[model samples]
Target: MIRVLVVEFTRPDAAAVALGRFLRDEGVEVVHAGPVDTAEQILRTAEQEDPDAVVVLGAEPPSLPGFRVFTTAAEAAEWASGGRSHTADAPSDRAR
Candidate 1:
């Protein structure tokens, strides 16, 4: 299952909330409502949840130590899913 860390500014937009719900409903292990304000928490949550990647919505980009930014949640989620798409892909470990 692809775990996701969804960050939002003033709560999530409709699509963002729906995205989290859909991911969980689809049996994806999502870190639901993982909204955070600080860049540090975002990084820490990523470390703790060890999500495949993050899906940000309605929030400014944060300067994290080592992370990529995507325009949309779908795009990010797709990028995160790429690792699971191929049989030859290596498993990823959550880093702290």
Candidate 2:
């Protein structure tokens, strides 16, 4: 199964929670990490989870090499569903 790490910089809002559920329903393993303070913390969590992809919400996107950061739950879900590719790196930040 595809493993996705969902990182929230603040308390998870409805959208974040719903994203987790959506990923679960898609048969993807969702690892939720958050309310963390810094980009470093986010990177550490990503490293620990070692997910195939990382979904970041409510914060500036960390410049972590090799990890594609999706700023919205819908974008993340679409990517996770094979509807998007990490190679399309332009416009890296999705509107929250």
Please give the clash total of every predicted structure, in order: 0, 0
In model 2, what lDDT does residue 40 have? Answer: 88
**Candidate 1 regions with alpha-carbon error over 4 angstroms:** 10-12, 65-69, 77-88, 94-96
Alpha carbon lDDT at 14, candidate 1: 69
Q: Could you list the CA RMSD of all candidates, in the order they appear? A: 3.9, 7.3
Tens-place lDDT per residue, model 1, 4-80, is 66777445466777777766765666675545667777777767776665666776767655544454767855665
Candidate 2 per-residue C-alpha lDDT over 37-95 given as tens digits, one digit per residue, 9 for 90 to 100: 78888888887876778888886677878786778898888877774544345432331
**With candidate 2 superimposed using the best TM-score fit, by how many Å does residue 91's alpha carbon deviate from the native?**
27
User: What global local distance difference test value does model 1 have?
Assistant: 0.61
**TM-scores, one per candidate:** 0.66, 0.78
Weakest 10 consecutive residues, lDDT, candidate 1?
83-92
